[model samples]
Structure formats: structure tokens, C-alpha cells
Target: MSDSLERDALKEILTASIKEQRAARRWGIFFKVLTFGYLGLVMALMLGWIGAHESESASSGPHVGVVDLSGPIAADGDASSQLVIAGLKAAFEDKNTKAVILRANSPGGSPVQSGMMYDEIKRLKAKHSNTPFYVVVEDVCASGCYYAAVAGEKIFADKASIVGSIGVLMDGFGFTGAMDKLGVERRLITAGANKGFLDPFSPQSEEQKQKATAMLQEVHQQFINVVKEGRGKRLAADNPDLFSGLVWSGESGLKLGLVDALGSVDSVARDVVKVDNIVDFTPQPSYADRLARQLGVAAATTLGAKLEWQLR
Candidate 1:
């Protein structure tokens, strides 16, 4: 009889535990629903606020073209030529826009990408001769970045900012010795004799070295020509090493005639542009987009947890 009573007690405990788990699960579902609902409401409110702000600003005053050239200036990067050109076009089309500002923060990337943007900026400026375009360098603007900057009517920078790395670079690794040591076979074929000149797995020939040097020299000359065209009479021709892939601080850059003035974005906007109010024309990711991204991450985490739980 005592054993029977113990079994009944054990069964009752198990049943009560199951009930508790069920209740907990219900609460969990409720909390998740509430959390998602709250996020949705917040997103709606943010969108409303942004729309209202845009409307109010549009009604109030003239717009300024503000294009953010952040990150490496590559065709594949966020600071792509297409995106920058689109922003510039939008600014140009805006009847209330007085001037265009290229806010640059980049170390640099593809020379081709930078050249494309520079040409576009110059063409646009020429097309809209009445509108002035200014460049404000932030943090670091070097190499291809400075190339684009010279397209601006005036260039401004912070005193300590890094500017000017006026040169081109092609990086590669040679692993012929390492591959030989490891008994690895390199299987590479090219149509042209000099096509694989910079191949790492193969031994470099004297002819290849000469060819590569000549190619780099040609590219360097092109870079120097672009700089000359952009800077015009401002750049001192005395410094032979100006285009030798060297960087300089904002102070030295100013002395070298790389930058026009030393000032922060706020100072330029308030003092130089002579407008107290400013509108950011740079496309910012919306809050809803950010929230959706966060939610996607959270969902992925939850899915991963579920998979782990199932595996366990």
C-alpha cells in the first residue's frame, strides 16, 4: 500500500510539472508577440517622424547636396561611383538646392572608380555652372579619395586628418619557393606570353619584371596627369615625390597645396556655407530597415537554438 501511494504521488508531481511547463510556454509566446508588436509600433512611429521631418524641411528652405563618400571608393563598395553619381544628380535636380557638398571619409580603393566619380563631378559642375561643389574631407582621404576631392571647387579638412597618398599600388604574393617546399604543383595557363607575369606560383622572369615595371610606370604617369589637371596651377611641381605613394597630415597637405582649408564639417557648414540649417542628402538606412535586420538576426539565433535543441 505504501508503494502504491508513492507511485500516485510521483504521478501527481509529473503532471504538475507538465502543467507548469505549458503555462511557461504560453507566457513565452505572449512575451514574444508583445515584443514584436512593440517593435512594429516603434518602426511605424519612426517612419512617420522621418516623413514629417522631410516634409517640414522641404517646406522651410533651400536644400544642399550632401553626398557621403565613406569607406573604400570601389565600384563594389558602399561608396560606389553609381551611388555618388545618383546622389549628385538628385541634388542637381532639386530646385531649392544651392550647392553640392561631397563629404569624404576614405583611405581609397580602385583608381578607375575614383576617376569615374571625378569625371562625373566635373561634368556635373560644368553643366550646372551656377551651383558650387565643395569637398569636406573627414578622418582619412588618401590616394583615389584625394583624386576625387580635387574635382570639388574647394577642399576642406580637419587639421589632424590624413590626406594625400597620390599614387597607385598593385599587391601580390610570390609562393613559388613555398610551393616547391610543400611539393605542390602549380597548374596555370595563359593565352599571352606576358599575361601571367605577376603569378605567384610561378618563378618570376626578368622579362616579366621589366614588363610589370613599365606597366606600373604608365599607370603612375596617368595618376600624375590626373592630379595635374585637377590641381591646375595650385600644385607645386618642385616636389617630384608628391606622386610617389606618400601620405601627409592635413597641415602638410595644406602646405603642399593638396587641401584648401582646415576646418570641421560644422565650421564649413556654419561659417563657410553661411547657412545655419543643413540637410543631410546622404542616404541613411531607415530605422525600420535596421530593426528588420536585427529581427532577422534574432530569428536566425532562435532557429539555431532550436536546431541545437533538436540535435541534443
Candidate 2:
């Protein structure tokens, strides 16, 4: 009886060990699969394969396409013309896009970038005449942001949204006084007569200042012409402050014919486009791209090389 009892005890121990080993193997497999899935997701995000408009497809049915334009627009920024234009192209080319809306919230940026976007919007609008293009402003759409907004068929904004800064300025620091007090002299040699124009450490030149002022005026006139061509008779031409570089509330902008009416993106999509479903077509930069851009900017700053000499 003692032998039989010992044998039974041994058999039970063997069964328990087998069960434990099987469970450990199963758990190991589960953990390995979970880790791989997580890594895949991270890779997809880093490659921009899964982003704002990842779900864009024909099966989505009819929807309003939205392209976001926010922050300071620049060649190396998220709101650059290249990205914005890419979004616009995608939105226009999509068969299910009932309309395209540019959701803007920017204090403006590079005029060149803004102009490229504006021209693309116009081109897209003409190509997709059946699909209406609109601009919905949030926060402030002044300066370069407004420059692009004018290309839209209609401009919508909240009553309190800030709009319009129809002017140009060349702003810089003059460190000559501080340098003089510090007994530091700057020695800059250039082959061109105006090569050292607007040097902060050098003495101010009246001729250079006049030239800068004239250039600003010319750009300002170009901005004014674009606005006039866009707004046409709707603009309140009698308003002296219309192009005076002053920002105004959306309510005041309506009076000046700067904005068509007060509305939001949702309201426009629902009421105007007759589509409640909206898909973002804005191209979000991948993590790798963003990191590269940041590195480039850092290098430029360290080298004291200005990426853009002019800002809108």
C-alpha cells in the first residue's frame, strides 16, 4: 500500500509539471505576437501609413474633404505649400469628395508658400468646378493665411475670428548701438554694393532703408491686387482701413467684405456641402520626416544661415 501511494504521488507531480510547461509555452507565444504587433503599429506611424486620412477610400461613400492649414507656414514646416497642395490635389481627385474645405488657423507665414497654395487652390477649383471650395477660418487668418483664403470661393469665419492684415513689412533688429557700447566692431566685406544690406551690426544706410521700403511697398501692392481681384465688387472699397495692416473681428470683416459670413466647418459641411461625413486629407509628416526637418533647422540655426530672408 505504501508503494502504490508513492507511485500515485509521483504520477501527480509529473502531470502538474507538464501542465505548467504547456502554459509557459503558450504565454511565451502570446507575448511574442503582442510585441510584434506593437512594433508594426509604431512602424506604420513612423512611415505615415496610418495618419489623418488613412481611411480615405472610395467605399467611404460621399464625404467632404478637409485640408488643415495651421501654424506658421514655411518650406520646412508642417503647413508648407507642398503639403497643403498635396492635400488639395488628393481632395480634388477623390471621386467621393462632394466639396473641399480648407480649415485655417494661422497668423500667416511665408508669402511664397502662401502664394503657391493659393494658386493650387484656384487651379483645383477650376478643375473641379462641380465641387465647391471654401475656406473656414478659426482663431486668426491674417497675412499669408488670408492670402490663401482669398482663393476660396467663399470665406467663412466665426463672428470673433480675426481676419485681414493686407500689408508687408521687413522687420529686423539693429544691434549697432549695443555693439558700439560693447566696443565691438563688425568687419564685413562684400563684392556687391548692397550685399551687406540690413546688417544688424553695421551702421544704418538711408539708401538701403529707402530701397527696403520701396520693395515692401511693391509687395504690398501685389497683395492688394490679389485681394482686389479675389473680392472684386464685394469688397467695401470705401473702407480706408481695409488694407491698412489692421486685423479686425469677423463681424467687422463682414462689413468690410473681407469674409462672406459667419460659420464653422461642421455647419458648412452639413448645410452647404450637404454631407455630414468629413475626411481630413491633410498630409501629416511622418516621424522620420519631422525629425529630419528639425535636424535641418537646427543645423541652419547653428550656422547662422537664414532659410527665408523674407516673411509675410
> Worst 10-residue stretch by lDDT in candidate 1?
303-312
lDDT, candidate 2, equals 0.85
The TM-score, computed over Cα atoms with residue i paired to residue i, of candidate 1 is 0.73
92-186 per-residue lDDT for model 2 (tens digits): 89999999999999888777888898888888889899999999999989988899999988999999999998877766677888988999989
lDDT of 1: 0.74
What lDDT score is found at residue 161 in candidate 2?
97
On lDDT, the candidate that comes out on top is 2
Q: Report the number of clashing residue pairs per model.
A: 0, 0
> Per-residue lDDT of 88-197 in model 1, one digit per residue for the tens?
77776667777788999988876777888989998999999988889999898888788888998888998898888777655556788999999999898889876666
User: TM-scores of the models, in the given order?
Assistant: 0.73, 0.82
Q: What lDDT does the true structure give each of the candidates?
A: 0.74, 0.85
